[model samples]
Target: MSPSETPEVVLHDLRAGDGLPLVLVHGFPLDHRMWDEVARFLPDGLAVVAPDAPGFGDALLTESEPSIEGIADAVAEALAARGVERAVVAGMSMGGYVALALAERHPGLVAALGLVDTKSVADAPEARDNRLRIADEAERTGSVAPVRGMREALLGETSRATRPDLVAEVGAWIEEQRPEAVAWAQRAMASRPDRTAVLAAYGGPVSVVVGVEDELTPIEQAEHLVESSHDASEAALVLVPDAGHLAAVEEPEHVAGALARLHARVTR
Candidate 1:
């Protein structure tokens, strides 16, 4: 893709009376497909928009290095391009970072907010360096190996022990991604700044979902979001049992239920 061009997004049934527009942003190493299960249980009237980030899923990597804020801006542009001026914007993990950036940079475009399995703080020094290391390894290998093990690490203990099919499915998704995309995501995440203030400033209703067993971004992270977002008129924090970082995939029904509630808040 060109340096200035934004990745295009697929839209679903935004016709009149289709209800509020919603955009679901995917996390790192995964694509729009990650939300397949959650979308199934969302309120029926939503005009859903799910887009692969710049380099994950079937999208191509750009010549320029991708930034979370840049990706958020691109998503905003993409939505406007699709005749959507505003929508309920939600994301998971890296996508949550992008969602926060979007609200920071283009608050007018976000009618409501949903943050799933994500945090508002920037990576610590060691974590940031590790991400850079992984990015370097991925670029050198020209493969997603550097992040392949995350498929297991991302799951909760219960999932790792009992959900072989889920593990295999996550592994398959990770393998399909290109090394460039992985590197791009790592670079973007490594340099991200704390977004607690963004969440604290947001005026819309908010939803925060995380697996109770999610070690990566734990329940504390979810609570921090709720505590920091006192400005939001409403906030819902959901903990999915027996799931992990990939709660939306590990236990779709629970994740879907959280999103359904967010949709209700948006329309209420």
Candidate 2:
């Protein structure tokens, strides 16, 4: 395929394959590369595409203000550009917020939702305040330290001591993020409207994947989502063993397996 015919190789783009289209949205601090291993392990005939949010990875960082909804719109545009009318959209953490936003705003483009290690609740006032404080610190001293602290927070307690290398890798990814991008995302997340209604309102299939050891978005959060969602009885909940926030990176095989099961349930 000619380069122009293919999706732009930026922070995020469409990976070429055949069967159903699966859009993977990476969590904060990491780019689409975070999904590389999980994408490789997906079922054959699945066209896996991981799009990077603007300002992260190779995405062309414009001067636009950042918001999860804004990012979702960008993804929708990218998919339209690629002739993809609908896709099974999967997102991790912040990506989940974007996926839900996309599904809500452009109902026709999202066939299903795969929410991984994420939540449906909006940030509490304290949480939003904390984020603002962190953003201020990041702005003052660069985003690397705050992001490193965030990296530590995302990992399971055991990972800090047992999987230092993984922690380092995640920290490095955060450190590599452009400061402006990080700041923009922080503000966007703070300003985001509550999306619990989206979960309750959407009628399409939804799957919630949580890391057993996740501290950022705990199992309780997943339970809350499953209970609150419109398709609670049918929505699937997966708890990946030994994985933390970044389940796809921490336990790629387990995440891939969950995706396969969700795919079967949603597409079959």
Number of the top lDDT candidate: 1
**Model 1 lDDT at residue 109:** 90
| Candidate 1 C-alpha lDDT tens digits along 69-129 | 8789888887788778878888999999999999999999988899999999999999999
Off by over 4 Å in 2: 1-15
Per-prediction TM-score to the true structure, in the order listed: 0.94, 0.91
Taking the tens digit of each residue's C-alpha lDDT, what string does model 2 give over 1-268? 4311222225343356665688889888778888988977887777888888877888755766557777888888888887888888889999998888887898888788889999887899998997788778777886557777778887777677799898988888888888766776787788888788888888878889998989999999988888878889877898888888888888888888877777666578
Lowest lDDT 10-mer window, candidate 1?
Answer: 8-17
Q: Model 1, which residues run further than 4 Å from truth?
A: 1-17
Model 1: how far residue 103 lies from native, Å: 0.6
Candidate 1 residue pairs in backbone clash: none
Q: Which TM-score value belongs to model 1?
A: 0.94
